[model samples]
Target: MNNSFSPRTGSPQAGSQQVGSQQVGRLYGVGVGPGDPELMTVKAIRTIAACPVVAYFCKRGTKGHARRIASDAITAEHEELPMVYPVTVELPPDHPDYGRQIEAFFDESAERIAVHLAAGRSVAALNEGDPFFYGSFMHLFLRLASRFPTEVIPGVTSMVSSASLLPRPLMLRDDVLSVIPGTLDEESLVRTLRHTDAAVVMKLGQNLPKVRRAIAAAGLADRAWYVERASMAEQRVLPFAEAPDTAPYFSQIVIPGEGKRG
Candidate 1:
């Protein structure tokens, strides 16, 4: 695989367009929702069903969570394009090499998808959760949206799904909610948590221990609820203090805001 950033240029197409003798196709960034297939929106399902090619990002050895969630809508006739990652958590995200490698990989992926588009084959890029929210599909969208006719279909995010499973409202009355990533430095995490009335800390795999400490230090641990793989079959929900030592990447800690009436 070539690790170079080389983007091909083309005229954007709304529907099928006749670029000379060839017809160009539209691009769809379809959010497949979090975990459960039922959570997928009607528009998302319709888009996936209409497209001739389906694309998804995944780890080298996996079929991709997004593809799995959208499986019921996909048929055998759809051309699958699995954009495998070059590296996943092998190096620190702060490392320069990590950025360079990921950028190159995204560039290559965009080009690959562009090939299908230029050939007049409509491509549906499947994304887990909301495509605009921490979805890998964003990378491809940035590279391809301007050069192709594009539409982004929204879906249920894991954060909202977890909140529903908890059967708890995120914020009420005038309360504020902050969404934080567990990957932040411990001090930064603690600082952010202290100022927020309600919060959801995501990306808690190896950073579980650190995130727990930060939440505790912020005096929010007692209010936090730990949910693993929310909306999935293997789901587990527990109090923050009762949570296990290790957590999956899909796990999160949600601290609901204190309700108040004005």
Candidate 2:
């Protein structure tokens, strides 16, 4: 990948005459890494610094975490757009149609972003982890990639960072490391955990207790260490026995004992 920082210019659409002398704009999905600014890659920082507008996902009534992660790297003059996603108990494909609602929100957000792109302004949508790894910014990319020139800058993932915080290796020798979403059903969890020597269970908010039970039942709980908000100022790392039932969604459990290369 070309990591050089160069100004990108393009017209809004084919046959669309340029208004005044402004150039066309591009959309960038820049991963800000897990919480710590120092963890952000040099390429990500340069992209944010150069983009004319910065967009980030946030809960409807809460502050934007991604934006905060990239604040120091961005100049005050850069435009900030907080794209809000409603946080509710509505289940997917249910009454309020969670999927529909979120899809609509992404579409609308893309339209708003298109306005900036049309003006030839480069916009960078900040993501917490690798843009393509379960990050909300991927929704925007799906919606706008066909219509505009889009680029993704990958960032350090929390799972890897969390593993690094440990005293032991996540995977060893020929051991496999499975990264599973804690939302999986009990049976699925058992099957996956039984096969992998090491595993990183993410999205451990409301489903933490369930995951904890699954790991324990699978005889892997003792090997796991839970890390919440890894790399952040308020980071917490504890054994599975001590992890709280109400850990945040950002929490992850790393099982190191199962895999030792040395």
Candidate 3:
């Protein structure tokens, strides 16, 4: 793995040259939906099925959640590209080396994907949930979209899936929704919760206790719902107060809006 990766800003394929069927291999950001294979869109399925190259992100030695979601649809002949993160939470966010390490990883990954794109071999990067919503696929897209033809396929997000588990709507007319991650500081978390009509707090893995306190301080603890692995078979839904001390990375706290039209 070369740490110093720099590719020239020139398309390998001529504007008129075609690879498989098109001038260049277009990159497809395919959203495989939240946990469920059935929830994948028809276009996503078709695009993935048509592509020979499929890429996904995962922790080292583990299969990607996005790839697992699309496992049923994948064929034996598809070339798998596992873009494993070189470092995850191993260094402080403010550390200069942290930024450098991540940037190097993305640059290398982009260059690797660009090879397929330049050769006209279409590549589909599978993403769990909606690709644009806090997705790692966006990193590759930012580096490759301008140079290669790219398309994004939308799918069901966990926020919406969790909302469906309840009897009421996530929001009604004029209801504002705030989506926050528990990674924020306690004070900031409290402020965001207090100001929002409805809040969906994600990344509650180790932040559940803090997030719970923030919800209580913001005076929405009773109105909040703790949902884990939404839409999955092992899903669990509970009131915020009743939720366990710990939660998985996929868990979330949904604070319903007070606004409901009569």
Q: Which model scores highest in TM-score?
A: 1
* Candidate 2 regions with alpha-carbon error over 4 angstroms: 1-23, 89-96, 257-262
Preferred candidate (lDDT higher): 1 or 2: 1
Q: What is the C-alpha lDDT of each candidate?
A: 0.86, 0.81, 0.84
1 against 2, candidate with superior TM-score = 1
**Clash number for model 3?**
1
TM-score list, all predictions: 0.89, 0.86, 0.88
When superposed on Cα atoms, how far off is each prediction in RMSD? 6.1, 4.8, 6.8
Q: After the best TM-score superposition of candidate 1, give how far the Cα of residue 243 lies from its true spot, in angstroms.
A: 1.5
| lDDT for model 1 | 0.86
Task: Give the worst 10-residue stretch by lDDT in candidate 2.
Answer: 7-16
Per-residue lDDT over 159-250 for candidate 3, one digit per residue giving the tens place of the 0 to 100 score:
89887787667887778899999999999999999888888999898889999999999999778999999888899999888999989877
The better-scoring model by TM-score among 1 and 3 is 1
Ranking by TM-score: 1, 3, 2
Candidate 2 vs 3: which has more TM-score: 3
